[model samples]
Target: MNGTEEIGCCGAYCGTCREYLKTCKGCKPGYLDGSRDQSRAKCRMKKCCLTRGHITCGDCGEYESCETIQSFLSHPGYKYGKYRQALEFIRAHGHAAFLNAAKHWTNAYGRYPEQDP
Candidate 1:
């Protein structure tokens, strides 16, 4: 299987999730065609880790006690269990864990990830 098949426990594709794509863009060291506005997916993990000096959620100093992470989890419509599962999976299996658990948070509770307007 090509890299895309390496599924994440969160039901995400490690190879194509916007965060990974952002990492790819980081490699190129330039703004992707329209990433400045488009392609800015609303994943807290990606946003926090990329913009807030965290390499991974598990690496955060607050870890099990982080308010940002906990607040996100408290939102029932957001599927806290699944998100935590993904985080736990990442802690255990690294990025590969997201493959199985990468279920989209965007679709939960009839909510699609909101795009910046």
Candidate 2:
């Protein structure tokens, strides 16, 4: 599958994840694989997206106000900021553009400059 398909519902890039292709196979696929106990199975975002038939939270009308995503993005951990940034990027540019810019992302989470409006 392409890199866009590897992005998690929570905006994590599975392509840059260490567990990807080892213990997991991206968010949707890993959750559906069902052969092993994948972490995505227990992911709240993943379940919510699948239930709503959305590839990512960016597809949701309530993306900006959703409690689940807000909670995740507000975690004390710094890494969650990157997830929030990713979601914002998706909202502004679309998944294809996000994936293209994300190709240079070294960590599973990091900053990407916002596009000029």
* Residue 14 C-alpha lDDT in model 2: 78
Clash count of each predicted structure: 19, 0
TM-score for each model: 0.44, 0.81
Candidate 1's C-alpha runs over 4 A off are: 1-47, 53-56, 100-117
Candidate 2, 1-117: lDDT as tens digits: 355668888888877777888877666774554654544367788778767877789789988789998888899876788788888888888888888887888877665765788
lDDT tens digits, residues 4-117, model 1?
Answer: 222322222344346654544331112223345423645555456445444345546676787767776667854566556556555666554343334443331122232234
Candidate 2 versus the native: TM-score?
0.81
| Residue pairs in clash, model 2 | none
Model 1 scores what on Cα lDDT? 0.45
Q: Tell me the TM-score of model 1.
A: 0.44
Candidate 2's C-alpha runs over 4 A off are 30-40
